[model samples]
Target: MTPHVPALPAMGVVALLRALLKRPRRPLPSALPEIVTEYRLDRLPLDDIARYRAAFGFPGEHIPLTWWYLPAQRAHLAT
Candidate 1:
């Protein structure tokens, strides 16, 4: 069963919108990198996944494909 989660307050939404609007945008590279960048995970982050699922109301039976974005974003920032 999905747990009940509180909705975001109106001020919280306004704050998020303000932050996003004020953030600077980055430009994409003119040319693609000669070598492909790949990210590998030696082990799954089960605890983190569990927390993510609970927060997002995803079922715990399996890992959702969307969870991959977490690692991908981290890898992008690291490089």
Candidate 2:
């Protein structure tokens, strides 16, 4: 014989339906005032640049393709 599965209680089923039908709350706007911050990749410190290059295994003096994300992330966080 197959084992019988228990069903959810009426209250539990109602709560689940209410939860499923509930609308998502809208996100609140930022309270902090906007500020502009300038970022210059060329101005990065020599040591930091050296470390970045070394981490990515770039022997030559050039920024890697993956390094572009740094500036993009900085800009996004600034907003």
lDDT score, residue 8, model 2? 70
Cα RMSD of all models vs. native, in order, equals 11.6, 8.5
Could you give candidate 1's per-residue lDDT for residues 44-76 as a string of tens digits? Answer: 988889888988999756897899888888988
Q: Number of the top candidate by TM-score?
A: 1
TM-scores of the candidates in the order shown: 0.48, 0.42
Worst 10 residues of 1 by lDDT: 19-28
Off by over 4 Å in 1: 1-38
User: What is the lDDT of every predicted structure here?
Assistant: 0.84, 0.77
Instruction: Give me the displacement of residue 61 in model 2, in angstroms.
Output: 0.8
lDDT of 2 by residue, 1-79 (tens): 9999998766778788999899869867769667777766567566766788998798888767677687788888976
Stretches > 4 Å off in candidate 2? 1-42
Q: What global local distance difference test value does model 2 have? A: 0.77
RMSD of 1: 11.6
Steric collisions counted per model: 0, 0
